[model samples]
Target: MKVLVIGANGQIGKKIVRLLSPTNFVRAMVRKAEQMPKLESLGGYPIIGDLEKDFSYAYDEIDAVIFAAGSGGHTGADKTIAVDQFGAIKAIETAKEYGVKRFVLISSLFAGEPEKGPKSLETYLEAKGRADDALINSGLEYTILRPTTLSDDDPTGKVSDVTAFGKSSVTRSDVAAFVAAVLPEEKTYKRIYTFANGDIPIKDYL
Candidate 1:
């Protein structure tokens, strides 16, 4: 399958690009030209695609999409709304236009209930929630993985539906691995899962 990974320059996105590039055709979309070479070296076809602008071209010949873009914690609510909310919706629309079926979204654990999350991240979660809703209603086969506080630690290759093992955070690489593991599986379609680091191997746990 050919997958278009939006925000392929981000931490989790880069890992996903590397994981998918070897077995599937990866169209890694980043915002700048400088970000191209690393993804290329990772065995992906890197292209420039800005979420804040027109990026419809990135969907061409794409069989599936991985919406991994985010505005980051430092950005204001406006940028968050623009990228996380509106940008994701636009991608869903384009995917529909292109007749693309499969989509995987990297979402936050509190997106389903933003008000219950940390006060400082309520807006971010709200934006993610809106994007999640968009993809769910877009008539595309979709999977949403909402992981708790993301850490930059090495992957455990195992995950749980709840926080356990004294580990409250999910590693970015594990999340990427989960996406790769489930992307081609029919059982995960139209599923919304919330997970964290744990003892079950990803393929078995899911």
Candidate 2:
């Protein structure tokens, strides 16, 4: 499988590129030229493309896509809409145009119910929800992973599909592992689920 990982330089994105590169060809979509070397060293075939600009150049010969890109909290609402919402929607369109078989999205836990999320991040959450809707309506195979608040702790290699795990957190590495594990599984191709660190083994879910 040849996979293209958008926002390949982010915390979870980098891990996805690393995990997929060993088993699948990876096109790590990075924005800056300086990020190429670091991503390449992680076994990814670094491809330079900005989400805020043209990214179609990076979709050539890609078999699948993982949209892990985000504008983050510090960036204002406009950048968030530009990168997270429209950027992800464009990626799905590009995947359809390029005949990519699967599209996986890295979304937030309360994306589908943003009003219940942080008030300050309401705009960002809405963007995610809209982007998720775009992918669902695009008529392409998709997997949407809505993880709870992320943590940097070492991975426990365990996760569960628990939508009501209040204040629960998941490690970035575990999320990446989960994405890599399920991409080839047809059962997960069209499902949208929430995951968090839990006693259940991650592999069991896949």
Candidate 3:
């Protein structure tokens, strides 16, 4: 499968590229061309693209796309909306225009449910929530994986089968693994699921 990973320079994005490059035809999108060498070294076809701008060129010949890119720890709400919400929406639209088969989004936990989250994270969650809602109803095959607080720990390749959060945290690598695995599965298409490190079985949810 030919996969395009937006935000391939992020912490989790790098891991996803490394994991998918060995088997799939992976295209790592970066804002700058200089970032190409590292991803290329990892057996990825690096493409220079920006989420805040036009991404029509980036979608050429792409089969699936992983919306893993986001604006980092910033203070302004506009930046968050621009990068997280609007940027994600743009990517999805472009994917549809290009006839991409599957779209997988890396969203955060408590995205659509603001009442259960802290006040500070409410805006960020809302932005992701809006994007998730848009994709869910976009009439294209989609999967939204909402994961709890992310860590840099390695993946155990063991996913919790449960959908409810029970005071558990998931590693970033595990989230990336889940996104990679879900994109090719028709069973997970159009499903919105959440993930964490707790001992809940993910197979039951799938």
Candidate 4:
């Protein structure tokens, strides 16, 4: 599949680009020119674009789209809403406009509700949930992965439903792997599920 990854410079996005580039014609959309080489080194065709404003042109020539951008933890609520929320919705619309076959979103567990997470991050979560809702209502073949607290630990190549694992976390590597695995799987289309490290292998859950 020809896939376009938004926010290709991020912690999770970068990994997704690297994992998908070798097998698929992947476009890594970075916000700055400096990040292009990093993606090119991983075999990705890098494009410069920013989700904060307008960059729908990047969606051209892609069969699938992955919205993986974030405003980071240190940013304020405005940035959260602008990038995490508005930016994601914009991508969804652009994907639909370009006749993209599928859309995948990287979200977080406990989205929307401010009561379930840390006070500082609740706004970000709310924005993420809004973006997810937009995608669900957009009439596109979509899959949403809402993972718990992210870590840098080595991936186990295993994942389970967040409900089955309770409150938990998973490594960034595992999350990227899961995204790469589901892109071509028809079983995951239109599915919205939370994931976390567990005994069940990734394939089994998919």
By lDDT, the best candidate is 1
Residue 179 of model 3, lDDT score: 78
lDDT string, candidate 1, 27-142, tens digits: 99999899899999888899998888889998889999999999975589999999989999999999999999999999888785766777788788899999999999988999
Model 4 TM-score, all chains together: 0.95
What TM-score, computed on C-alpha atoms, does each candidate reach?
Answer: 0.96, 0.96, 0.91, 0.95
Could you tell which candidate, 3 or 4, scores higher by TM-score?
4
Model 1: lDDT of residue 23: 90
List the candidate 2 regions with Cα displacement exceeding 4 Å: 164-166
| lDDT tens digits by residue: candidate 2, 69-139 | 99874589999899989999999988988888699999888785777787777888899999999999998
For model 3, state the Cα shift of residue 64 in Å. Answer: 0.6
Clashing pairs in 1: none
**1-46 in candidate 3: lDDT tens per residue?**
9999999988889889998988899999998988989988878899
Q: What is the C-alpha RMSD of each candidate to the true structure, in Å?
A: 1.8, 1.3, 2.1, 1.7
Which of the two, 1 or 2, has more lDDT?
1
In order, the Cα lDDT scores of the candidates are 0.89, 0.88, 0.82, 0.87
TM for candidate 2 is: 0.96
